[model samples]
Target: MICPRCAASLTAKQRNGRMCAQCGKRFALDPAVHGKGMHDIRIRGIAERATDHGRLKITLTQLWYLSRSRNYAWAGRDPQGVPARIRWLVALPVAAALVACAVLTGGVLAVLAGAAACACVVVASSMRHRPGQSPHAQIIPAEQTFRDLMNGSWSAVYGGLPEGVVDDARPVPRPRGANRSGASVPVSPPKAAILCTDRVVALFLTANGIPARLEAVLVEVADADGTKGRPTVLAAALSAIAQYRSGLPVVVLHDADPQGALLAPLIRGAQPDRVVVDAGLPVSAARNRLGVVRLVRHDRLADAEQLRTVAGLPEADAEWLGEGFWSPLAAVTPRVLESIVVRAVERALAAPRPTHHEALTHGFLTWPQAPRSPRTSRAPGTRPPGTGTYKKKGTSSA
Candidate 1:
């Protein structure tokens, strides 16, 4: 809790009456409000918005366990019971005095005895004891029970999460230059890549073998002059700087919302010839029809109007988003989404087919399919219709 007067951290010890150390003012805390709730109302509100309260709460509880487990193994500021120099300071003087005394008496053994005794005592006491817990230990474990309550909420929402996504979600250190799953990015850049708006979705896709990066999907890309049509976004911004100048096929995957609906246009601008596919979130029908487990929020996004104006969403889909509702990208499982994205890129890179529309598109024009030779396509005994094989004036036959 913050001090109403000066915003310093207030503790339970000073709950009733406390003085603000910074401003030197006294204030009272409300027992009913401060640090009091089954779950913090702010978080609970976000969780309950999509009828996913129980599941999110359980995740919060798992988060709590991970946090508390960290507390149990946390280290302290001070790491020694006493100063290490104290023992040396005490013994060095005593050893010097004994050697001085022995010099006056002309005794060699006495000097050696004093030096050895001092050395023994110094070695024994010089090792400082390990430090204890921090002064904040009193409040560190206070939320243990809250975590328990969250765990007991009985939510099955994790079924929608991709395997290993939740485990990797925990904030633990990974090897430098490696991603959350301890895998370094491939040396050869993928032929094409997938970009996601949310960091969580990016991490999930990257962990599951879809070459992806954490790139935000904005509702619209603003210009240097802050204009709409001349907008700039990640892929488009990179292209202007000659990044995807070779025309790399960029696939965009995002949540179902106004901001996501306009993601492709934002990346490709008015009209682009690149193989950038806007494989954004599916419509409500497609999501349900495909049995995609995603969380739908009956709320509005800040950029709802921008999407309706210029996103070019099909009529039925635009109507749904205009009514103010959305879904999180995590609603689609990582494996499911990854498979879809990989297949989309593969088809884009696959052999030219009879359909041939996309086969000729997306930078495959230069690498045209080889034309078949006359010998290869014809049967062994057959020849072109106009050329009869080895004519010899009817071969002087019959």
Candidate 2:
């Protein structure tokens, strides 16, 4: 491990107290104390990459995935089998015991003992190991374990979390007069909305001011009950926004699981008049992608069956979901995730507004003509053209 404070390679002895012997500077996250590959320098590097060098803010969940040792699925056969050496060790002991018995006992007794020993050796040599049970298998650490390391040890040593990394597990304080039902109160009426299935992703966007920059409301969908009912808060907000600003577009950002696959369709079904863009993590994006975390849950078999009903879901993706595979949006790097969302919002805004009898139509034909430049003189007989200003939205645009 290299000392984060001094840039000097540190031996276990030198970093025994989490202090560098060279500069005598203290640092958090000794690899020995935390899991392998979790030194302070590596943690900082992961945070930097995840946050795009402080240009974006990421949540602890994103940091956890970025810091994982293995992000892709295990290929080929399971690597948890007992070693040949261990099998040989067991076999050798049994063989030696059998040889001793054969030498000490009479003919029939000796033969039976030898046969039993041979069977024992065969069984030992053929012992099958369970998947993910090997000591060498790179299991993902539990979220709580990673959180404890970051919040407890790392904070105690470094004073706080790394820059641009927010702890999503911590409860956000509700503003005064906030709704008790967990619906977020928008500071102002929004032109668009981002509906995220995961609270962590929503929190990441909110922390980084993505919603504010897009002039969009951020709505986090709570875990669904079996009823599969539409979220009333989302419905009310959309209705109210549409009354003031017609054709309010929505961007649905979600994971690559069955529930996520169903979210966009559910919203579209409930609000057929609104434009809902699905900017979610698809199964194809994470299926064979390098360095993306693909998790498995055996309990999602029923959920996978339900995904077949979702419109436009590929058969392969449906089968993958049926097999209980999922990938969280939080697993995406902060910069890339932000880019995807911004592009999706642009698409939503560019989509033609839903037509209503009372609403005035706005399109290429009906758009206002460009105004003459201030420097250009207007004809005396012609009325002054309307002064139209056009501003292009960028990633940093407010």
What lDDT score belongs to each candidate, Candidate 1 first? Answer: 0.43, 0.66
Worst 10-residue lDDT window for candidate 1 reads 389-398
Best-fitting candidate, scored by TM-score: 2
What's the TM for model 1? Answer: 0.39
lDDT of 2 by residue, 138-249 (tens): 3355677888989988899888899878777775434332345333445677778877777777777777677767777767664544234334434643454454444678
TM-score for all models, in order of appearance: 0.39, 0.65
The digit string of per-residue lDDT tens for model 1 on 26-114 reads 54323343333222333333344422333221233223322221121111245666565766677667767766666666567776766
Q: Any runs in candidate 1 off by more than 4 Å, and if so which?
A: 1-169, 172-184, 212-242, 284-309, 350-398
Global Cα lDDT for candidate 2? 0.66
Worst 10 residues of 2 by lDDT: 357-366
Q: After the best TM-score superposition of candidate 2, give how far the Cα of residue 118 lies from its true spot, in angstroms.
A: 20
Q: Model 2 segments beyond 4 Å from truth?
A: 71-139, 172-188, 224-246, 301-306, 354-398
